[model samples]
Target: MAVELIILGVLALTAASLWIPYIVGVNTAPDGSIPADAPDGFIIPPDPNVHRPWVRRAYRAHLNLLEQSVPFAILVLLVDRVDGFSALTLWASIAFLILRIAHAVGYITGTARFPGRPLIFTGGWICCLLMAWAFFAA
Candidate 1:
């Protein structure tokens, strides 16, 4: 239940989420094909026909998770700093981070279809809820 770890994990996932399109060349290639090279400086071919939709979806999902969790992370850190510690909040935040990363990886990598991604997504949301509850309860 380390708040530092939670923060670090959150930052890790956040960076990965933001970097995916550029790193993976999301919009550069034609449908289901990798581009020979990505375009320069934030401009690239648009994704055609939902090509590589999972990659796009994964990026957005991770970004959304980060957006949703940042406030909770801050609140947890603030409370932890003021109080001795917030074990519940810290654990929940860590859980959220772990689940988010797993969810993104699973979705992007084409892991088992249907239920697996949903479960991971659900796990992340539950962690977020737990973190929020701990923040308020504190």
Candidate 2:
């Protein structure tokens, strides 16, 4: 249940991140370019005057992380349900969440450079590896 909660929490953060793109889009314009429905928490900015396209794209990237990571977490959860949580499960889930958060913030903020991006991306992949380890170990 604790693992489940952490996953839920991660997902909630992911959901919050969704707002960045929606707000960005609304601010920018009704660009049909973006895929997927805009989530409710994030507002579609009423006035186009405040639009910033680059920022919108950056926000979309964060939204993209949320979009991708949640499914992976669900897959992990399903595996956990069947096999049970191991040390690998706990550590991997933690790492996955952290990397996802880092990935979202680093990419959107653009503060972290190549190594930083690699670190977070690798961390996420490592988490998956941990899951695989658990599957094999089980």
Which candidate number has the best TM-score?
2
Pairs of residues clashing in candidate 2: 27-51
Error of 1 at 11 (Å): 2.8
* Error of model 2, residue 111, in angstroms: 0.5
Measured against the true structure, the TM-scores of the candidates, in listed sequence, are 0.62, 0.65
Residue range 94-120, candidate 1, lDDT tens digits: 777677667666656667358886777
> Model-by-model lDDT, in order?
0.60, 0.63
The regions of model 1 sitting more than 4 angstroms off are 1-13, 21-23, 27-50, 81-84
What C-alpha root-mean-square deviation, in Å, does candidate 1 show against the real structure? 4.9
Residues 42-130 of candidate 2 have per-residue lDDT tens digits of 33322223345446546656655766576666667666667757766877787777777777776667675688877777777777777
Clashing pairs in 1: none
Residue 61 miss distance in model 2 (angstroms): 2.3
Displacement of residue 5 (Cα, Å) in model 2 is: 4.7
lDDT of 2 at 108: 64
